[model samples]
Target: MPSFTRRSLVALLAAGSLGLAACSGTPSATPATPAATASDGALKVGIAQIVNHPSLNDLRDGFKEGMAAAGYVEGSDVVYEERNAAGDQTTLTAIASSYATKDLVVAIATPTAQAMIQALPDTPIFFAGVTDPVGAQLVLSLEDPGGNVTGTSDFPPVADQLALIKEILPEAKTIGLLYSSAETNSHIHADLVKEAAPALGLSVQEATVSNSSEVAQAAESLADVDAFFIGTDNTFVSAIESVVQVAEARQIPLVVSDPDSVARGALAAYAVDYRAQGVQTGTMAAAMLTSGGKAGDIPVERAKDLELSVNPGAAQRMGVTLPQAVLDRAEHTIG
Candidate 1:
């Protein structure tokens, strides 16, 4: 149920859906003014995301949990209008446009955040999944956003992840950097790896993809690389299974920036808990809306609950055996 995407998620499994679930709210089309609520005075919260994937799905769930923790229980004081663009740019714009009139919008990814900001300059937006928010220009600054946008940042701990890759694949030299070129955060992650790799005695070979369809080809192109490291690019993570298939077929060690990919069949990750990130974003959003704090006035948060996760089975499938020390270091492990 959590794996399905978008409007389909609602029709088929809204009762048990994950990312974009149960969106039922009514608000005036007057766009972004405060005090906007549903017909019954419930907060009209819009849940928008670019696509449906494990981490993003957890993000959506975590947001609701966070909001509840902040005393805005769903179906009680707050109501929602959830929308997933399903990776379609046109649909993303439509979702953002619709969210413009809501009291608040929680954008689950960078692309969705960008669309929401563009469509409703005055709307309150709390985002999760953006690695480089400042570079994406969703906010003026993390400390002082200077506008109607502020939320949590899921910047990958690239250096740590790279070091983990090196530890897991000691003889590895050139590492493949696979990501969606369209994601600015992916670029930022790649650059971070390139910048930090040499110090750890590793080189990078990049394979930039424009969309999910290109993932397999991009990965196959980097077949000669000793190992592959993919970051938090929504497009790339959304299509992680393709990369996993290629890795197992070629026996190339695969490391990813997303911890959830471990369950989907990646070796390991040093990642900020994305669900925790959503909680952070939702808490921030609730504070702003409830306490009358301006979006700009709230400081943008950087995710800090980092966890090291590993899949022993994935490593075996990728033709590598993890050392006991590696397993000991992991905060979580999958079969």
Candidate 2:
């Protein structure tokens, strides 16, 4: 009988050099056979991030877990190549370009995804934490996608934000919408907030910033507002400390569209867990790869659930008192 070793068997299967039912040893008579032409070794996966943070890390970890669930175990059937931009678009583009040759690229945020889409036109791409895939030009439409990009969106329930604003500040006749004009997600969310505010007997004041350097001024410009609404703008999130500084100094409460923003400094926020979006993206990727379905066939999806988070410490600092009704209903509270 031939001496069979695990490494030799794996090599044979990986190279399509040989096929074997099982390693001959003192064991069960019937052994598991290697399926002919089965997936070679690990599927190469690339992950690109605009920056590294707890929220983004969750998405990466979730993607890993989802891949595992899809029968792609790391080191065995999957290899993850991760890159971070440290909040720089130039860096993001460089990282995305570097991963263009990977089997699959999963971009964590809007900037990274857009960079990947522009850099790797043919590579299959999955994006999470994007607000508007169509607006970003990542896809032609949510229905057919019509491209190599598809993933999940973290667009907050815009109407819900307005509703929460009204509930929290009934006397707030005019609310301020602060965001970066360049961010597609921020623009979409701002529009939604505008459309919904009027119905809630409130008016919206648009305070647009072109970049992080202007966020503090934008926040200060909206200081007179009864409430300051922060959209999911990467530029703004990157400059959250500045915004929070102005808001704190002015005693102006902030309501953000991301939980992480609240954790960082915002008074309160409603958000969808981005990591869960990563899991969703991974599942979609697995389905597409396993069935040979095109990425375009899977339309971009929205968050399945939203979480409400309140920061009482921030609220107190800004003199914004959230009613018990709202507080009790929140998924999490910090103070």
Candidate 3:
């Protein structure tokens, strides 16, 4: 896969952040100590999750680990309130609003982030695994967030995945992009594919779904395309099994933005670990809580370790065998 030009990468970053910014509030200065009272030994933290899924579960677990590492214990030093919206925007807003009294709120996924941005601009908010924080309008810039929100980004280098797809399917010419029309993260990947695909002699066909209910139909719409490229689309992700059924039935290879999706059925994926991204965000949150760093003062960080995951079952089902070179490079393989 070819590399993204500095300019294009910047553009993608910008778009992702702006989209997140749809929910915004005033920026605050970094705090001087842990947000919680040390003597009381309790920090009230609220977590608003847009949906209940395995990936989000990884984030929650990572967050707990990060907080524990920072000396916050579950039953003693910290109090946590968790809410899952199940992908309903109304429920998301309600969950975010309910957390207004907490010392801090951690919003997972773009929708939850957006809701928190709107409902609690004054309360410090940390985000994790978000694709484009700036483009989503959640913050101003990665270096100087310019708002009371900052965390870790799960924004993988899409260009590299595009290159990998071509390598896996040398004869592939038309790549189908299946994602949610409503998600800012999906659009970020779309723009990236548009920018990188032409250079590889591939054209992209887009199929949009607004919710999980429509994923099957949307994926089937790409039947003519040679292969499918999976973005970090929440809608599509929530229905991974269905998406795999449609793609595999058509004998179309699938590539995903996150490695875990590969284990579920995608042929191969070039991605960063979602739990690692959560841990990154959690580390920053812990720093802010323990070291007096301001949420708005710190820049959002990107995933440092990328992974390649392959599913032998998916490949076998599709009648495609990945060469040893590809398999050797994989960090994990699921059959």
Candidate 4:
């Protein structure tokens, strides 16, 4: 098998110019084609994603990189038919059903995974960016999936995230939870925050949005809270700038579960590296394809590394101060 490094993948993404398109379920005109082909036969892989956010885009790139590392050359030995749902549930189901006959289908988020599970019961499915597989009922267990589905889970580092919030805002009493109620992962994170906050001497306030348009209003509704916590909820993350605007206007410190969001203006985050999660899922999918293994035989994987990201300028704008110790511990500190 060949080895593809992160540097190589970054170069590939840069050269490809992958950007978010208008909300649509159609495949991009420029699908990621592998430069090399396998000597034996090409493998057809279907990648269905929930939306075109940066984190999901990075996950898609990482999946391709992992396939390359496994000696599955795109265009040559492998071909990827990529589809994005653009945050539309109808599109998600349609995309999943379309990939029902693929050699292997990889779903990037929880909704896509659920759609694939329903649409392709016999087909192998690899899911990434899912927070709670069991809770979503996509699998029976993490250790033993017991079905034709397995992949990586982007379970937020809820405890760590709350700890970071406490470190930065010691006087914080009530932490507001901002997320979409329709997302199972959002519910999981909300429950986690509610369960974890009390021990940290903080209370939890809830604000839910059914869609992205309501995100700002929802955040504003929780103005009584001392701080805001945004989970890896796709709906909320896709419209994070709205939440950021609300946070800045209200001077409420915003903490997120995705490191990429920190770069977008959230104060800080101790979250999973989504690209790494994609690589892990893609590698597993490659192994299954190469060996003709069943998804049921493989156990679901969880993110092993968490990155700490802090933005001091965002902190100052939100009326929070990041102590020197917290700044020193951060793996990424944005300006």
Candidate 5:
């Protein structure tokens, strides 16, 4: 498949620190250690993504924005070669191998990061949107990367998101979970749902798939459940329309982990902003490259701002009625 890309002409870094608010997800990071290196030439940056889902796309675009803010002028101070694996493991591996000679590489999600680390063990690599870097073994620890890899993690507050499901469907007893079996990110969220569901008096019914082609059937298999919950699984999010179709047909209220999918027809979401995460990761990348720092020198950060987004029209389509309280509490509401 052809590579997915955009001309990333992001801005210079803002003058002040972009602080993350205290939250209970991944721990906030300590600032990257800096050591300046004098250079007048542009840096080459390679971005690798597992697929072209909007969340990952947002992360990519945001990374460029962060880099731009860091004072790297696109095509002048910096140049980018972005590649998307289109959900193929072989293509992802090939794409990772191709970035061996670039100044640095940004892997957009867990799978892409894993592939890149495997392909270029000695290269500077930063990952964005990875949910559990520790679980994936991408880093020895978030505070101390201990290797040539470090970046941002997008571990949404799954327990809080599960609570939102119960808030919307007070009498609902079971929520169906659809995710990819191969993704560590998906597994982490699935475990979270299982861990949190009982607290909300809800049981989880899960449907797993290995690829996008199996998505619709997987959604169909969970029709018996009262509601649907989606995570940041790249495969499922890439084929989100199938999940939406099934959810609407069955009139199952759906809650998700990010705003983009809410626009795609899921009823609501509570998630860390993808673009913000990109900027966070981008700044780290800039710090590492400009300061002659290794990836391990920077602390891995999680999203600071978590947004509650709701779409009443989507709720109606999925046969859900949102309480006015939920709508009023939303930071963003999709029409």
Candidate 6:
């Protein structure tokens, strides 16, 4: 396993930023009030995101859009404050604590949600990007959170993802999983993949990393495996290109759980649309704000829109061929 140098990572990020800029468009915004106090009859909302990545960034943008669609326009109906922890636990704790004064707080990832749950035990908390709220212990149950928490879950259809992998590489017998051990969502997805892969005649091999800096090394450790399966792990997704560099070199097909990752060079993905998850979360939060209901009153929702994405060039680089049926079913395909 080769370790990535700081200079190499910087170059990779620079290239990624350029690619993102080329494809990025202005996000839609609505009129919302500046930050205000609850005493003024205005709604105060705080959003704490664990880190800045393409998928999480999209989730954040979609959240604001969803809020606007729900009639809570920013700069008019609601006072919104957004913060990012940059994947630091201490920063997340500070950000969570700062939201204590807010009327409602929306946490974007598992870690941030956990921080909010700890810092604002009684405050209304809406969460997104969480794969398993119950497993993370953020809520008692998905149906009735029974606490100051309820939101959308980004739980990927693990079986569908694995089936896609098998469909692309029917001769594959071992599937490699690259994920972050620190993320509860990663563990949940990894467990599901492990359980589901066996039925597809695939054995699971895992390589865990604690942060983006370790992703290259972890991915390299799994070089001998037949294919790589990346779940919706924030750490891995944040540094996907590094994994792509190795996968392309080794000709290992990379299948991810987020469609956004496919555009980043992964071979394919069959999973939820994270931005839609944010919209669902925001809609639930809007209902609470409108009815003045408690957070616990809303049931935790799952992302309803699932789509398949394939990258033909990526598949070719990884030495895998996508069948016509799979291509026909894909909502999006990148050449």
lDDT of 1: 0.79
lDDT of each: 0.79, 0.74, 0.77, 0.80, 0.80, 0.80
TM-score of each: 0.88, 0.83, 0.88, 0.88, 0.87, 0.88
Q: Give the Å shift of residue 319 in candidate 3.
A: 2.2
Cα lDDT of model 1 by residue, 1-335, tens digit: 01223343243222221122111111112222233343587888898887778898888889988999999967758887777776777777887887767888888877788788889888788888887677666766677776888888887777889889888988988999997766666666777789999999999999886777788899999989989999887877878898999999999989988889999999998898988988888888888877897897887888869998999999999999998998998999998
Q: Across residues 85-118, which tens digit of lDDT does each residue of candidate 4 receive?
A: 7777777777777776678888888877888888
Worst 10 residues of 4 by lDDT: 16-25
RMSD of each: 10.3, 16.3, 6.6, 9.4, 11.7, 10.1
Q: Tell me the spans in candidate 4 whose CA falls farther than 4 Å from its real position.
A: 1-40
Q: Worst ten-residue run, lDDT, model 2?
A: 17-26
Better of 2 and 4 by lDDT: 4
The model with the greater lDDT, 2 or 3, is 3
lDDT of 6: 0.80
Q: For model 1, which pairs clash?
A: none
Residue pairs whose backbone atoms clash in candidate 5: 11-68, 11-69, 12-68, 12-69, 13-69, 13-70
Residue 310 CA displacement from its true place in model 6, Å: 1.0
lDDT of 6 by residue, 1-335 (tens): 12234454354334311100010111222222345543466688888777767778777878888889999867668878888777777667777787788889988888778889989988999999887777677776676777899998887788888998889888999988988767777777787889898899999889987777788888899878999999988888877899999999999999998788899999999888888878888888888888888999787888888989899999899888889999998899998
